[model samples]
Target chain A: MLKISKKADYALMALQHIAAVQFGDVTPGRVVNTKEIAEEYNIPLELLAKVLQTLAKNALIESHNGPKGGYLLARRAHQITIAQILESIEGPLGITDCSHEKDGEFCMQRENCHIRTPLLKVQDSIAQLLNNMTLQDMMGGTPLITIQSPTAQGVER
Target chain B: MLKISKKADYALMALQHIAAVQFGDVTPGRVVNTKEIAEEYNIPLELLAKVLQTLAKNALIESHNGPKGGYLLARRAHQITIAQILESIEGPLGITDCSHEKDGEFCMQRENCHIRTPLLKVQDSIAQLLNNMTLQDMMGGTPLITIQSPTAQGVER
Candidate 1:
């Protein structure tokens, strides 16, 4: 199971709220504040604040300042991906410990391991599916990003 | 981080050893006991024993009883899949906690979640890739199974 961390979940929810508020046409220049989002979704303020900061630092969303200031999508919703958000919150998504490590680090199991290579293939497809899914696609918006086989892009399977 | 439990990794290693020893043609009808696999992979004997029992119970591998008693593949290598092994050890693979629960159970975030449906799409593709890949495919054997889109089979995307 590829466990999506709680913080990652919060981040996506927060972004969704911001995107809706900013782009819903109800409020053209409005920003979504953390308090409103946290209160609405019943997410913890401190945790949701930290998640928003991470997303801001990662450039997925931009922060605003003023009376009605908060956060807004830095780019179009379609430009952001679940992969980018998840990777920002968590680290890289590797199903196995050695799947992301090219040298296998100090893994003693590496030499005897025949499963690592195949598991890497599994991890790659996971990353691929994630990368192809945009925030717009996720919110029932237009699915502009299409799934492409990593192998088709000259990536070795 | 979709953490594959250490027990699941050990189970895969144990099965790989069994498949190689049993079907490598160097020795036919040989049974691979837990001790051999444990020592070869430097895995703990007690934990590996428990994992072997679970695999046996799942019928992914069969255990023999006698002077030559050990473990053998319950089916041919190509007949087994990583999805089967991982599920046998780690239950169903769901990216989100609520993705597998259609009714959302007692999850409070269900109503606020716009990501669940899209995450399900991601999870489905992950399952599709894992289901199509066999133990034999992992071992560099002829890939008799080809990848198929679940949606093409009339399963909803």
Candidate 2:
């Protein structure tokens, strides 16, 4: 199973919530507080806060610290992809460390690992798909997948 | 990050180990014992046994009993896909339960869950990629990821 961590999920949901409110207006000052999002979405405050912090640290979103402080997107919705949001919160996205050439922590059997190269391709396939999907494409009722023959193509919204 | 469980990792490694030894011979009796696989791969015996048991139950592999007994693929290497192996070892492959209509445990805000549908599409994209890859493909030294531009097309080994 390919599982996205809860933190990554929350980061996406939170970003979508903010995007929905902004409605393509990329103004820097328009923001939503963590409490408002948590209450509206029923996400646990602590968990959502932590997820938001990572997003801010990755510069995907900006945070204000005043009494009326809140959060806003650092860039336009179309500029951020699902792959970027996921990697920001959860680290590099790949099947395993053996698939990563720069990763220092290779499995002990990696030198003799037969599955490494192929799994790296699987990883790239996944990364390409995710990288193609943006936050703007995720919002609204538009269908993301269009089945034109056996090959499923993604429609970028 | 999209994550495949350790059990699934071990399962793939073990299956690849068996497939490499078989060398495309679809004979039903070339067996590789769990002990040998665990020792060779440095995988924990208890964990590999559990994963193998799941594979056996799923009928992806046939297990033999007794002192000289071990296991062999239930079908040809080309017949078994990475999706099947992962699903057999690790339940259904998806990012979230909210995407599953029959899944009773929907998030508290499922009615307002804006990302569920798009996430489902993401899950399908991953599954389709995995389904295209077979156990036989993993056994060879062929480059799995052929970068045909930034699209990252999967090459059948």
Candidate 3:
């Protein structure tokens, strides 16, 4: 029942793209633009552009200026955790709105709320798992098909 | 970014109400009807009824037929896990639509989808947490306020 928001998913996908083309610590191997990623992933260019800017603002990826310059990972792939990407896009992982981490008590049953503690624990544990998971961890799943034959291997395989 | 559905939340609340009034094996100390839970939680009666039916269908809670009869925990509170409640309401936890568990591959980037592995891990880990966690774990947070003063202790405290 728990689900990650679509924007957060978009951010993950976008980050994985940059991470895949990552070159070195300071400069990216390829300064992949938003349009390039949008076309490849079939994502909306306008939406993906907004998401990329948010990533740049969060410092997960730095936006390069001028032509041929677009986006690159601010940190190494393995060094950046999925939690950071998600938090950068969706704030800290919150399973329930009435979580202790939330500012004010909006839930009516706060005092008698039985699920609060367990819900908070679930939120923390999920955050912990995501915090430990890096973008490289997700990028690791990209090796099944080789790029030799795009239509055959990449498409059908 | 991750969140449990409202129906699932309602199901948990309803089950907890029954679990709170549980007596012993076979017969409950108190039979809880859906309306009681709906009014108590301020949930819509119709929606909560459908959710309660799902809980009954999943065998998480036993349904009573007569006027005095209502609902009871199908199994002991501790015997029921939050996963059971959540699954009963929302099906198995799914982080991404393109996970291996899905019937057919839908995403165009399925072959090169780098997130499949890590997303599945997150799904499985979350399911693992919910599976191991019993309903009693959430119910444990309900011991703070006593029933002495309704307005003062329960509302203001």
Candidate 4:
């Protein structure tokens, strides 16, 4: 089955939570504590902490240490797309192992494999959808259909 | 990036090859040698052998041992969809871990996760595509379009 990993899903949810509270007059650029996030979401503190640390390392979220420490979005809510979160947590959004151009060159049949073509199409479709969507979109209750509907009439909102 | 695993890709290719040859007196029930498949497609013999074995175990293909041994499609080529091949190799097709109704019950935010709905839609879209495409479609040279294209027209022919 093709599915996103738990870590990736958690990463997106955490990002959405941060985006949701961005309007509050909390300390500007203040770090959001992992404990608060975990408690609010009812997620496992330890696991979510690790996920946050990874996000920080990937520059998806900014982290601070010491007394007034926590995590904050490294960029604006609109600047961060779901693709970035997914890539930070789950590597690349490739559909086949051979679709990755950088490391994928090592595959035995990289040059002439017919399957990579369609798989690449699938990967690109998913990536484009993820890239075009922002944390704000997810928070605004904008269904993904708004961005993906084929008819131009549906896109005109 | 989303990508298909080697096992799944190889299974699709092997099935398509079988479908192509199954026309004209070649019954899908007849055994085919692994070496023949490997040599014809220039695939890695060892890896292809394991992939074929995996398919046979999943009931996608039937295999025999010894002289008259190889593999045959367990079902008609038209009856075997790409989704079945992918599931046989990778398990289930879902964009988020929470997309699975059975497994998603354990998620901490099962009661109110907003993102789950969109991810489920993405999962369903992918499922719909794979389910609509059969191994025979691939063998018949039905070109797969890039996901960016709204039309379902074949790419090559």
Candidate 5:
């Protein structure tokens, strides 16, 4: 199945946890340990720790090494979109290799393949939705609207 | 970047090759060799051979060996959607684990997470596109159209 890797999944969960506590006075700018975050979300400790480290490496979240150190959002929750979190963990958001503009030189069929065009559209729609959502938006408990209804005609996006 | 796996990519290339010749005098049951398909599309012979075997295993295509042997579509080209070819190689088309209905049971945040809903919409959009596109349609070189332009978004399906 096409899936967000384990890294991306953990990153989102961690971001949401950080967002949930952002408004609290005591924990403001404080290091949030991976243990605490993993326990809160019921995620595997070792896996979540690795994921947290990855987020830190990507600059999506800040980390410290001393006694009270853990992780924190590098920027404000509102400033971090789901797309950034995803990209931080999973690399670029693209459906087909041919859809990537960054390395278009590699695909031999780039000049004439018709499938690339529609797949690009699919990628665009997904990006639009992800870009519109921020960690804060998710924390705000906003109702996510369906882009296509189960009964609706047309494409799923 | 979000990308289709090598398997799905090869499957599509192979299907398109088959569709291009579907209208010829050759019977639907005729077998086409992997080497010919690899040569036609300039794909690696070993890789194309493995992909063709996978397609046959998934019933997307059928194969035969011996003096007069190769591969043939298990069904009419028009009846085979792009989704089937992709799923055969990549499994379910999903952006995240939670996007899958079956995996919902295992998701830790299924009850409260907001991202799943919109992500599901994106998944549906992708599914619809794949479902609508047939091997025949791709072979016919239909001009692809999308409701939105590619650059406006950032999410990858």
Candidate 6:
């Protein structure tokens, strides 16, 4: 399991596109509309548009409406984390239905399944790792940032 | 899309069952049969049997046949990692089909998807976190262990 939705992926692709362009451009938050991103990344326009809508609604990105309109990061690139982007596009991040206790005791699996508690721990670890990563870490010209154990501070550059 | 397969879930359930029992008095490396695990967890017998076969084959656990035969941890409970158990049941973990470069170059998505590289990094972070955790870390009686950012030198325990 542990898969990211294509919608989230597209959202990331679109954001990375804007982040890369804005890294040094004159337009500090200038819109870079969906059409241009979809074409450059070969993403399906309709699908990417939906993803963009979710991000815009979440205020992760700003959407413009005019003919010259497009999308731009609502915040600085480093202010955006992959976890926030994923949550905006795909809701909560859980690898399993029973990852949270509120999933209830309706199923028989609940009777003997001790995995739920541990699975939740797994979910937490994953969410922590995702939350730690900023979009700036993955954008073009930046080396992919590595994960530091939640407690490890500034050890692995 | 981040979901663990039923087989992997069952595998974790079975391992946890064995680990729980082993945590108590009885015998070290005590074997717990498939029928018992399957019935207790309401897992499909045939499916869990296949999952156990893969785990046994991968040496995550040992299996025996005949009436008194069943399965036991291949090593100490503390030595078995969740990543090992999951990978044994599900093969290599790839969050996306294109997670690995060997996914082939046939799809157009592979040609232009900027997300793949960064996604692979995300996958690596998940895998590393899982790899760092031993089955004993999740077994009953042990308080849920918190993640120590991968380099903290074991502070959180």
- Per-prediction DockQ, in order? 0.34, 0.46, 0.28, 0.31, 0.31, 0.39
Error of 4 at A72 (Å): 2.4
- 2 against 3, candidate with superior DockQ: 2
Candidate 6, what DockQ?
A: 0.39
For candidate 4, chain B by itself scores a TM value of 0.79
Please write out the lDDT profile of model 3 over residues B17-108, one tens digit for every residue. 77876753654588889888878887889999999899899988889897987888888877898888887888767787665445664676
> Which candidate number would show the highest lDDT if scored against the true structure?
2
Per-residue CA lDDT of candidate 2, range B1-157, in tens?
Answer: 6767788889988998887666645643467899999998888999899999999999998999998788888888889998999998778887885655575676787877889888887777677667766887675543324333333333353
Query: In terms of TM-score, how similar is model 4 to the real structure?
Result: 0.76
lDDT of 6 by residue, B4-68 (tens): 78888888888888877766676655678999888987888999899999998998888889988
TM-score of each: 0.85, 0.85, 0.81, 0.76, 0.73, 0.80
- Location of the lowest summed lDDT over 10 successive residues in candidate 6 chain A: A148-157
C-alpha-based local distance difference test score of model 4: 0.69
lDDT of each: 0.77, 0.77, 0.72, 0.69, 0.68, 0.74
Q: For residues B97-145, what per-residue lDDT tens digits would candidate 1 score against the true structure?
A: 7766765374567777787777777777677677766777655432224
lDDT of 3 at A33: 95
Q: Give the TM-score of candidate 3.
A: 0.81
Ten-residue segment with the worst summed lDDT in candidate 4 chain A? A148-157
**Per-residue alpha-carbon lDDT of model 1 for A73-139, expressed as tens digits?**
9999888888899988997787887766675364667667767756766677777778877788767
Q: Model 4, B1-157: lDDT tens per residue?
A: 4667767777877776776555525563466788887776678899999998888888988887899877777888778877889988888777776666684366777665767776765566566556665665454343333343334332221
Interface RMSD of each: 7.1, 4.1, 12.4, 4.8, 6.4, 4.0
Over the stretch A1-157, how does candidate 4's per-residue lDDT look in tens digits?
7666777777877887776665445645446788887787778889998999889999988888888787778888878887788888878777776555584255654443445555554555556567776776776565554333211112211
Candidate 2 — which residues are off by over 4 angstroms?
Answer: A24-29, A101-105, A141-157, B24-29, B101-105, B142-157
Indicate the worst ten consecutive residues by lDDT in candidate 1 chain A: A148-157
Clashes of 2: 0
Candidate 2 has a TM-score of: 0.85
- Give the docking tier of candidate 6: acceptable
- Give TM-scores of the second chain, every candidate: 0.84, 0.83, 0.80, 0.79, 0.78, 0.79
